[model samples]
Target: MRTHFCGELNKKNLDQDVTLCGWVNRRRDHGGVIFLDIRDKKGLAQVVINPETIDTFKLAETIRNEFVLKITGKVIARDNEMINNKISTGEIEVLANHIEILNASKPIPFQLDSMETSEEVRLKYRYLDLRREEMQKRLRLRSKVTHFMRDFMDKNDFLDIETPFLTKATPEGARDYLVPSRTHEGGFFALPQSPQLFKQLLMMSGFERYYQIVKCFRDEDLRADRQPEFTQLDVETSFMNEDEITSLMENMIRGLFKDLGDIDLPNEFPTITYHNAIKLYGVDRPDMRIPLQMVDVNEIMEKVEFKVFSGPANSENGRVAALKVPGGASISRKQIDDYTKFVSIYGAKGLAYIKINDDGPSSPIIKFLGDEVTQKVIDLTGAKTGDIIFFGADKSKIVNEALGSLREKLGNDLKLFNKEWAPIWVVDFPMFDEADDGTFNAIHHPFTAPSVSTEALLDNPGKSLSRAYDLVINGSEVGGGSIRIHQSDMQKTVLKLLGIGDEEAREKFGFLLDALDYGCPPHGGIAFGLDRLVMTLSKTESIRDVIAFPKTQTAACLLTDAPSSVSKSQLKELNIKVTLPTKN
Candidate 1:
């Protein structure tokens, strides 16, 4: 329908005729000489209809924002005064010789250039919203990134294999979106939360290497980076260890960055133990770009007279950690109050601080602590003359979360972070953690294999460590994976330790257990969240911007208004009933 794209017109095509079809981005009629900014997916081009072409000029006046049109014109250099330095096609304009109204559009619901529109409104009008330049660029970049990954994997002999979307529900780390079977009456199928199980089965089937850009679903709560349905670059391999797989994936990421641009990524990714990450940063996913780290102050606090600090320090499940905010002595009282409220959202009872003034700890709580205790805090934190320290003391979980999150906040507030990137592998995670009810649950999943040395601890259970690793970038968990137990006995033991009895394990994962018995190869893989990864590479903070279409925080599709009720007949066919919760 068109000979050239809007962005393709330049000085080289100054006298050539071109046919272009796109929407009118803007229209201006200056004393009957009509001008239109024609836009397509590529970019914008100016089309001029002079007074000599009176009929076309009159027709252009009907074209408002978003009116689709096709024009045949001769490209000509724009007068110096009319040149636009912002675009590549800035040097020239097309003088319209022929014009046709391909389609017409009503006034759009929202402006394309405004970033202040509500996400709901933008999503509802997503087709128009995607026409915006930024959205188009982001989607294009995503495509390029996927292409790069695929090429890199293919060159390494990884097969682009697909796994099932509708499969058995094997509790693959998230709640599956189940599909009811009308034919089978009571049977149901589930959307995969990942290709975790199927990818492993592929290894058993003798595929040495595999990769897939696949969609996964989960019936889970939403976060800035999470959605009910998401995409992942699922990968798996047979007979590869932790370091081998990690190095291969790390090299792939570096190659991708280099191919896209000469972006200098670290030659080698750093490694950290899960235990050390929690103790130093208060969170396993710590932002290496941020120089600040948490310091243990429980010993110093235990010696103080302040009960607020001493109480938790003496308790079994409690901890006291401080995040030293560099040059934060000038922080206002209001800012501290704001930070207190921020931590409260994460279930913290209160936020404590000891602002180091010109002399020493100057807060009111400083009076309760003796000189020795105050000096210990300063020494332990390595606090300089201009630093202020914030403390979180509570149960271990609360202390980690509050203090961990405070580090992120202080980085932004005090501007103590660089824009540089850092990727690391957090290895040797606990295989299981005891819940409040004393039941043990898999920290990663039941399928994750424990280190051979820790296989004995499976009998003790509380001390077992898994051969799991997470690829963390700037504190975000971009990907996670583990080596699988190819042996049936080891798999059974690990499942048993996770509180899943043999009978239950057989009922849910009997097929996998049976497969292991038949001689499954030693296998492991990683699944990178495609959305989070692309967003990280693009330096976009919100994952939603990377997705072509994404739902709101409430998990409703504004464009389609999905999850709406269906007819009673539909429910009857699936042998299901819709019930509403009773008002208490």
Candidate 2:
């Protein structure tokens, strides 16, 4: 229907006839001459209609924004003052010889380029929202990213494989999105949380290397970086150790940035143990861009008379840590209170601080600690004049969560980032995390191999570490993987340590255990959250912006009005019944 895209016309095509088809971006009538900004996937180009062409000029006068049209015109150089330097085809305009109104649109609910539109309204009209230039560019970049990943994987001899979307549910950290089955009454099929099991099976099936850009679903609370369903670049390989697998994946990611965004990552991403990451930065995925770090002050605080600090310092599960913020001595009382409130959301009782003034140290808690202990803390934390040491004294988990998050907030609020991009590998994660009741849960997954022998892991489950590693960029975990337990005994042992009894393990993952008996290869793999990766590459704050169609934080689709009710007959066919809680 068109010879050239609206954006493809330029001075190089001057005097050449062209036909363009697109939506009318804007229509303006200046005296007798009419101007129509036509837009298509390529981009925008201005079309001019002279009064001498009375029919076409009359039609152009009636056009409005979003009116689909086809224009036959001759590309011409724009007048020196008329050139739009901001756009690609800015140097030229199309002189319209004919205009065809293909379709007309009703007045749109919101302007395509308006920044003030609420996300709810934009989501409701997502088709229109995707037409915006920014949205178009983001989606285009996302396509290019996926394409580059596929090309890279193919070059590495990884076969693109498919995994079943409808499969039996296995424990994968999150609750699965179950699909009711009609063939088997009262039975359900769960959407794959990941192809973790099937991909392993693929390796045992002798594919050796497999990759898939797959969809995964989780019935969980949503956040800016999370969704009900998301895509991941899933990969698995045989006969590769942790180092080889991580090196290859790092090359893929480093090359992705270099090729797609022209951003160069380091030759080797720095690595840290999970314990050190939490101890220093308070989060395993530390934003190395932020220079702030948490210092252990438990030993110093243990001797202080202040029970608030000393109590946690002396307890086994408790911690006393301080974060030194440069030039924060001038922070006002109100700002400190605000910060206290911020940390409180993470279970902190309050945010204590010792401000190192030019005169000397000062704080409300100074009198309780006395001069000797206060000076020791300042010395220990290296809090010089003009620095403020924020303290978190509580259970270790709460302290880490509160202080770690506070460090990130302080970095952004103070503009303290030292670099634009920081990529790091966090490894040596604890195989299991102990629950409050002393029960254990796998840190990664039950299938992840332990760094120690099966007997050692079983003997000291609390201290056992996994072969797992995570790829974190700018404090966001973009990918994670671990070597698999190829032996059935080791897999069962890890599951047993996680408190999954033999019967439950057999019921849930018997297929995997049975497959392991039949020559499972020594393998490892990684799954990169495609949405989060794209969000980082595009420098967007939310993954929703990068996704084509995304649900709200409540997991409702405003556009489709999904999660709607089904008829009683349909429920009966699936042998299901609805029950509602009685209102009090």
Quote each prediction's TM-score.
0.97, 0.98
Which regions of candidate 2 fall more than 4 Å away from where they truly are? none
Q: Write the per-residue lDDT of candidate 2 for residues 1-584, one digit (tens) a residue.
A: 99999888788899999999999998888887888999999999999999888888878888899999999989999999998989999999999989998999999999998989999999999999999998998999899999999999999999999999999999899999999999988889999999999999999999999999999999998899999999999999999999999999999999999998999999999999999999999998999999998999899888778999999999999999999998999889999999999999999999999999989999999999999988988888888999999999999999999999999999989999999999999999999999989889988888899999988987899999999999999999999999989999999888887788899999999899999999988999999999999999999989999999999999999999998999999998998999989999
lDDT of 1 by residue, 545-568 (tens): 889989887778888888799999
lDDT of 1 at 470: 95
Judged by lDDT, which candidate is best? Answer: 2
True-structure RMSD, every candidate: 1.4, 1.1
All candidates' lDDT scores?
0.87, 0.94
Name the weakest run of 10 consecutive residues (lDDT summed) in model 2.
492-501
